[model samples]
Target: MNKTIFITGTSSGIGQATAQYFEAQEWNVIATMRSPEKQNILKNSERMLVLKLDVEKPETFNEVIEKAIAHFGKIDVLLNNAGYGQHGLFEATTSEQIHRQFSVNLFGTMEITRALLPHFRAQKNGSIITITSGVGRVTVPLVSIYAASKFALEGFCESLSFELASQNIQVKIIEPGNIATNFEQTTKSNFAADEALTDYSDYLKKMDEVFKGIYSGGGSTAADVAATIFKAANDESNVLRYVVGSDLQPLIDIRNGGTDEQYMDVLRSTFVPEN
Candidate 1:
């Protein structure tokens, strides 16, 4: 029987690329997004099934999962890719933005995976792949809420991997550095900030300049991330985290090589200016 992978946030970027990759590999692909009506690129693909799934809406998860399984007979993998960035200073972020950030990234990812656990346990086999960010490990300025959510996911999946191992289910996290995606625009749209707070004016200016440099520097392509996720999905071993993009490896090493204070010093030197 052909394997089936259910991926969320497939409207664009790595999610869409992975759906295409698996479909080409002759796997049944459930490519879901907030609006299935907007996805025209992969609808016609031979083994692809585009569905609607908004991670923010926990009420809709069971229905989507049921439809995916009814169509494919079973789900071999679940890719938690439906998430966005909410960037700005911690003080500038509103209560609503904070809730929404965790709601979509951390809470929703958990909810959807819970909805699928019963089925995976019944089948006694499955893999769960989540697209977390490198910011989950090495945090920078202007993305506090975004980084928090990703960091939570990294911890969540690492622990979940151990629990799911007993049931013959594998849990994995994909941490990719800044990829070439429409996410920059999405981040702008999702942002909340108090422009009138001049206390951090110079700090904000420097942060903006640093972010522009990072985005422009170009770390990884969406295809690169997709390929990494593919490798993780196919991996039968119990490995839990797959860091994508060559540029992120050195940073990951630095973060894992030393104590928390050491990583803090490194982060401060990179993003904080000397006065």
Candidate 2:
């Protein structure tokens, strides 16, 4: 049987790469994005059904779910890959920015997963994979809001996996270190301000430089993450999480073994101090 996957945020970056990987492996992929008209790769793929999906809009979930079922008959996997980063000082970040982060990354994803639960329960088999981040486990300076949203996803998905154990619905989370993609460029920092707040502007610039270095140098590839997602989707035994990146394994191990301070030290060591 040809397994079907509904992936969000397929217009670019990791989501786009993952969609292409799955389709190439002969899976029926419902590649969704906020703008279907902008998706050349998805539009060109015979195995892909490109649809418009804005994760912040909960009302769009049912419509996309209906369309996906109509196109693929059944959804074997739900890849919740749609989210943006909110990077800046917590004091500078507005309530609106916080709300938008949670809306798209946490609440909206929960709504879609909830809607799909009945279908998974009926079929008695399904898999869910979410693209969380290394920040979910260890905090980094200037990205607390984004980290909080992913942290929530990690908790929610882990708990849901235990709840769904008997029902055969497997939930897995992929924690990828910064990757070389447009993902970093798309990050929005709430630190834009005039002379009154110019003191903090340098902080934003420094952080942006740090992000650029991370993505351009030490980060893993999107293709690597796509392969991990494919494994979690097809494997029969349920694995709760898969961490991607060369350095991620040691960090995860340290986090698992030692105190919070020990884990945070690893993060601090990576800090590129402003010159």
Candidate 3:
């Protein structure tokens, strides 16, 4: 029997790429998105099933999961990739934004995993792969809420891995650095700002420059993330974390090896140098 992987946020970016990658590898893919009608790509493939799934709404999960199972028999993997970045100063971020960030990035992922646990446990074999961020492991400027959500997800997955081990369910996290995708465009639109509080305008500008520098340097592509996710799903080893993007490894190493003060200084000097 061929393996089936149910992936969320498959409308575009890494999700879409992953769906394509898996289908090319002869795996059944349940590719889900918020607006399935608007999706033109990833259609007509016999092994691919594109469906509507809004991660923020838990009520929709049962129907989606049931349909996926009915179509593919049994899902061997669940890829939680449905999330957006909430970028801006923490002070400028509103309560609603914070809630929205957590709801999608953290709560939604957890709920989906919770709903699938019984099935996975019964099967005595499964893999839960989440697309976290480098920011989840190391902090950066101007995306505090987004980082918080990813951080929460990292902790949640790490803790849940221990509990799920007895059932033979593997929980894995993929931490990717800045990738060339529609993410930056979405983040720009979703970013919260307060013009009245112009005191932080200079800081925001500097952060923008830092972001521009990173993008201009040419980071990893969404396809690279898709490949990494594929490896995480298939690897039978006891590895828990797979860090994608060559640009992110150094920072992760620094965070692991350096003290808190040293890390802070590194971030400050790298992204917020004094003029």
Candidate 4:
């Protein structure tokens, strides 16, 4: 029997690529997104099922999962990739923005995984892979809320891996650096900016410069991240974290090697030199 994978946020970027890659590999793919009608490519494959799934809405999870299982017989893996970045200064972010950020990035993933746990436990084998960011391991300016949400997810998955190991289920996190996608546009759209708040304007300008530098240096593509996700899903080892993109390795090493204060100092000097 062909293995089946259920992926969220399949409308574009890493999620869409992962769905296509797995489908090409002859695996059954439940490619879900908020608006499946807008997607045209994946539906061409008989093995691929495009469904509607708004990760921020927990009420819709059970129906989506049930439909997937009914269509594919069983789900061997769950890929949580349906999150958007909420970028801005922490003080500038409204309560609603913070809630929505955590809701989609952290809570939604948790709810979907929780919903699938019973099925995985009964089968005694499964993989849960989440698309976390490099910021999850090391934070930078302007993306405080986004980083916090990913950080929470990273910690959640790491600890959950231990509890789920006994059941032969694996929990893995894919930490990718900047990927070439509309992610930048999406982040900008969600960014909370206040022109009247002149106190932060200069700092925000420097932050934007730092972000531009990172992107200009170039990073991995969404396809590369998809490949990493595929590897994590298929590998039978107990590995819990997979870091993608070469650009992120140095930052990860710096964080791992230094204390919190040292890491903060490094970021300040690099991104906010005047501060």
Instruction: Give the winner by lDDT.
Output: 3
When sorted by lDDT, best at the front, the candidate numbers are 3, 4, 1, 2
**Which wins on lDDT, candidate 1 or candidate 3?**
3
| lDDT of the candidates, in the order given | 0.88, 0.84, 0.92, 0.90
Q: Which candidate achieves the best TM-score against the true structure?
A: 3
Across residues 197-264, which tens digit of lDDT does each residue of candidate 2 receive?
A: 67777766777677677656667888999999999898877678898987567777888999888777
User: What TM-score fits each model?
Assistant: 0.96, 0.90, 0.97, 0.96
**Of 2 and 4, which scores higher on TM-score?**
4
The whole-model C-alpha lDDT of candidate 2 against the native structure comes to 0.84
* Error in Å for residue 58 of model 4: 1.8
Tens-place lDDT digits, model 1, residues 22-117: 887789999989987876787945588888889888898999899888888999999999898999878889999999999989998999999999
**How well does candidate 4 score on lDDT at residue 66?**
95
Q: What is the C-alpha RMSD of each candidate to the true structure, in Å?
A: 1.3, 2.4, 1.0, 1.3
Candidate 4: tens digits of C-alpha lDDT, residues 1-275: 99999999999999999998999889999999998888777683679988889988888889989999999899999999999999987888899999999999999999999999999999989999999999998888888899999999999999999999999999988999978999999888878887678898777777778778888988898899989999999999888888888888988888889898888888878877665
Error of 3 at 44 (Å): 4.3
The true-versus-predicted C-alpha distance at residue 219 of model 4, in Å, is: 0.7
Across residues 1-275, which tens digit of lDDT does each residue of candidate 3 receive?
A: 99999999999999999999999999999999999899789894679998899999999899999999999999999999999999987888999999999999999999999989988988999999999999999888888999999999999999999999999999999999989999999999978898888988888888788788888998999999999999999999999999988889998888889798888888889777687
Q: Is candidate 3 or candidate 4 better by lDDT?
A: 3
